[model samples]
Target: MISVFPEVSSQYLIGGEWKTSSKIKEVRNPAKITEFVGEVALCSETDVTQAVDAAENAFKAWSRTSVDERAKRMKEAAEKLSTVIEEHVSLFVRENGKTMVEAKKDLLRCVEVMSKGADTLLEWWKPVHVEGQAQKVQIRKRPRGVTAVISPWNSPMILTFKRAIPAILAGNTVVIKPATYCPLTVMSCLKIIESSFPPGVINIVTGSGSVVGEALCGDTRVRTIAFTGSTETGKKIMSLSSNSVKKLYMELGGNDPALILPDADLNEAAIKRIRLGILRASGQVCSAIKRVYVHESRYEEFVDKLKKEFERVVVGSGIQPDTTMGPLNNRSQFNFVKELLERSKQIGAQVESIGQKLDSASWEEGYFMLPSIVTNLSHDSELVRAEQFGPIIPVIPFADLDEAIEMANDTEFGLRASVWTSNETAAIDIADRLEAGAVFHNNHTVFQNLRLDFPGIKESGLSQETRWGGLELFTDCYGFAD
Candidate 1:
């Protein structure tokens, strides 16, 4: 029962203009597979070249613009965007399959990030003086020319602009290639902010990643690549950018964990993660809590409560007033989660399909999936070890804190993890020992304080996405004798 976003244009924003392409793609509603949201342009490498060239040409002048001016423009755009925010939010739910609540958060996050990125410029750049030998030295920060922001489709607009906002605010021209699955949402976002800056300062190129991604990462004109996607794709970007040695800022995949200690609020800990972290975005979040480690004393009790919570979740179209969860964004993701749940059961794990389809007759025709909860899974099972990127989660019981930490650290990814305990000392101690880029003492989510650096350890990522760290990421040191 969702209305189509009237102006989901199937065009590219290049050099401050909306350009059309011969090649086209369809943007479909995941909740109603046959329904087309709109047609989108499938740009080729040539299109990417044009976009990058525009950005490169603009960067020389853009980099010269004062930080104060850049911040002011972004602030103005944020205010302008707030007025038409509902239309954009609807686009996200229609195309991205985010629940109403989740869509609102994504839209708000985009605005907040833009506003925050602007405010950070107030303190982000500073000159350092170094008295070396006989001459005084001034270390200055300069923009890295054209920065390409390659964002993922899961939370398309926000993820793309989250990086682009900083790059632009730091005086670098930006060319963004949002995921083809939801390109128009990103385009719609760009359309609002496009007039806020000089022509060619902000651009959105839509197409298959193979064509556009290769072009962006491989383009020598693009000096920095801020990418967010799978770790495998991150590796490809690294190799592609190696020739130019482009500065790479990547926020990749994570198999985040939630560790519940004894004496914790078992229901709150489990339900909070399930509702806010895993079930949000249909568990498409890069930092979603994929694994859970519960203390032996509360293991059985926690499992019972967690199972009950999943059962109460109403799964249906995001537009439904009562729907608490929505469909998987696409088929490949749905298939992967479905297969993983089957494999866990085959491997002797206690797999329970707490899934009761809300719109049963039409659910399968679309990508709607009932949230599945797995218990008694080995710490080494695929479900526990890999990121499902869906509403399915595996709960593992641990005997002690030592075993919990050891089990948690056994993943190839370290994006985020949380420990639950009423003991303030124990919570802090546990949080300190985790290997994630960020750890929460009692709660976890991808949302971060805009002023703090949000980066991951191990393979989770290679750069920061928050205020100061974000600004510095797009700059190169220009040190000279004063």
Candidate 2:
């Protein structure tokens, strides 16, 4: 196998081996588009079929492998992952365009997610007992064959490994379909970690989602698909999987809200909203801070403070020292964000362009954009209603708490929201009303608590994940009483 740090391009990991294809796609560094990162071999539908076939064959034995053994192998993978983490850090910055701090956090978070799944698999995958008058009942969990993990480039490693590990721990084999733009990072990590598993147990097919993703989701042998991407793409996968009534685990888009109550701290709220909106993945995250709904009493104060903080954000190449954020990950995303900003102006939204570019000339060579703040937008405006997926913050003022809640819940997304206030009682009351899976009392975007459920309602996502629910997701429950 080639080194994790690729020179030009890398091969895919299929059936625990590196395989090649005739088609190759170029991967440019988003931080400096002129700099060639590498290339990745594109696989076809036949490759996806081969991967599913191998995973199906492997599942027969892997499913029966003891929990202790599976956990041990996963731990071994984690340890190996740490030893080579620096190489990953450097490569991640070059390929994905997230700052060094963000890249490091991404790597650590991925390890934490996978290790947590491995550590608790034995406890999470348990049989339940219920007593009755005549007979006792027991619920047993059974693996659901091969699981297809179709992961996106935004938080690629965390979402990919997090989705894949639970299914594998539940005794299901896995076929990974990584997004084309960031395939090398995932493929290299898998290359390092795949050694701990038996052949055919874990496989990956790299290519465009239109080809390989459809093939994996449509296959009858692939019983489950754990996906993390846009709601539109999730719908397509859902349709494809319906052919076989396959299980679908989706984490879709979000227009996440940050609401500031009348009694909120402007200093803290301003900083948190700015950081959450752009410092993370250039705001490409699915649950990023999308819209800000501040109490009209404090709207001007909050907006002014947020604009000042957003101005200081350091935008540059990811590998540079003291860089707070990096470029947009790809050309399509850059163009989309640019157009969104343009539309915000066309619709009469008050737009404030903020943020610093380290090298103004280098901006032309990279997919870089200074973060902008858009205010005075109606709830129905394109910038307010849609997921921009970039560093564009739309601040909308609400007259009362009820209006704030209404605006927060207006969207088709329910990933998360933040209620910034001092009073715990009011915070709880406000959080309870927001239509989202998780609510922060103050401000926090990305952190994992094993007990908390990471799910989305409405168009944001389907089904629940993390904690015990995640393990059960990969299994079909069966019980019988005598």
- lDDT by residue for model 1 (373-469), tens: 7887789878888878998888888887899999999987988888888888988788788889988866776556754656587888897755473
lDDT of 2: 0.83
Distance from true position, residue 267, model 2, in Å? 2.6
| Every model's TM-score | 0.94, 0.96
Off by over 4 Å in 2: 1-8, 268-270
lDDT of 2 by residue, 80-112 (tens): 887777778878888898988888887887677
Please give the lDDT score at residue 19 for candidate 2. Answer: 76
Clashing pairs in 2: none
Instruction: Look at candidate 1 and give me any clashing residue pairs.
Output: none
Candidate of highest TM-score = 2
lDDT of each: 0.82, 0.83
